[model samples]
Target: MGRHKALPYVHRTFRGWHVRRTWVNTGEVSQLNRARIVSAAIDLIEREGADAVSMRRIAADLGVGVMSLYNHVPNKAALLDGVAEAVLSEIEFTDDPSAHWTDRVRAQARSFRQIAHHYPRSTMVVVSRQLQSSSGVIPVEYALSTMLSAGFDGREAVQLLRVFIAYIVGSLLREVGVTPTFAPVRPDVDVAAIDGGLFPVVASLAGELVKCDHDEEFEFGLEMLVQAMIVRRGARASTSEPPESGVIPSPGLS
Candidate 1:
């Protein structure tokens, strides 16, 4: 009689567990599909341009209908977020932490330059989408942690990120001279006619343009910034410290 009375409670507990399991399975499936969609979109955009990325294009690549993607993602804009996340996942960091801060920052800068070379359209995706996605924040968070461990505040860390990113991106853009927008290279146009007569100096020094390799410039810039920051920290310590404790930061080639 007691067993029968408690049967309802047992059934409810099992039912609740079943519901949770079902929801977990559904979530897993959704994530898998979203990853596939993002990978397909990245491939398409790399082969084509941002202007060429359409719902139909992505759907065709995914072997699913355009409406089917909406089940996982609300719209194309949301899908682009996934694509940017997918593109950023390719970045890998070295395991050696003993390297100088300059080396670490320069490594990250060089990675960006290489990504720009391999995936030219990725910059557009990164620029267009917000960094609200987890993939976008991973590298940024790594940068901040590295900076903080090296003794930097939030504002200073962010400023250095901005400066480092801008230098690498701008340098790559100049090096590649990609004719994506406003600058047009017609299919049938001659390569050296227009600039030869009008901008001789630009043409003359065109050969002097820096290579796509960013190791040298990145190291130099990172070295300067890190040194300046260390000096600033040292100056602050000297001004406000007990002369008895001479634990000032040793300024090295970081």
Candidate 2:
């Protein structure tokens, strides 16, 4: 009988799975699965920004054929969604029922900042996508629940949650040098070269403007938001009395 040759990669026909093996120092092999694929996508995003994330690029990073990634990711949009979920899963949520609502909110926000700092370039994937997966929705559910427990009605809680996410996203975008148009910030301009006559204040604070302490500024904004929430809850409590008419004024102008 002739000897059979072992293939470098394998595809199981029964389950329609594609698997790749890589040699390790311990002589064991690691299988490339959806998790590994998503991780490679995140690595690409971190190194080359979100635009670099593609099935072919991730497959190259993982040392596999481009078609191999399709078995797991299916398409580019699914791949990006996976990246967002993976990054969000890194957040260590503190949902201690005994903790004060404000403390819980602060803990979640701080944890979010840590993840943002860890993946400055890839974090935007999370911000731009609506996280429908469990991993991404858990943090949001925690935030909404905290707001509700702190005495916010359903609409109020949703609106407050949107503002909270906006603050974090805006801060991280600035830290990562991404502008409103999603382009990288222009290289530092020479403030001294600017026309002092036209913009006196910008010239005067050039020293301070150039040396920003992002951490300190982030904390300042976070505390201000928290305090404002506290004040709002107190005011809502005091105004619990019903209006003469059942009509509740809309939250904003049409």
User: How much does each candidate deviate from the true structure in C-alpha RMSD?
Assistant: 13.3, 10.5
Give RMSD (Å) of candidate 2 vs. truth.
10.5
Stretches of candidate 1 off by over 4 Å are: 1-32, 95-97, 179-254
Q: All candidates' TM-scores?
A: 0.61, 0.76
TM-score of 1: 0.61
| Per-residue error (Å), model 1, residue 72 | 2.4
Predicted model with the maximum lDDT: 2
lDDT per residue as tens, model 2, 64-93? 899978887789999989888777776755
- Give the per-residue lDDT digits (tens) of candidate 1, residues 1-254: 11111000101121111101011232234433665666567777878877777778888865678888788778788878876765565555542357555456656666666666666676668756777755577668767766765566788888877777776666556445554322232334333444768877756654444223445655666667655666655554423322212334554312
Candidate 2: residue 253 lDDT (0-100): 11
Q: Give the clashing residue pairs of candidate 2, or none.
A: none
lDDT minimum window of 10 residues, candidate 1: 2-11
**Full-model lDDT for every candidate:** 0.58, 0.72
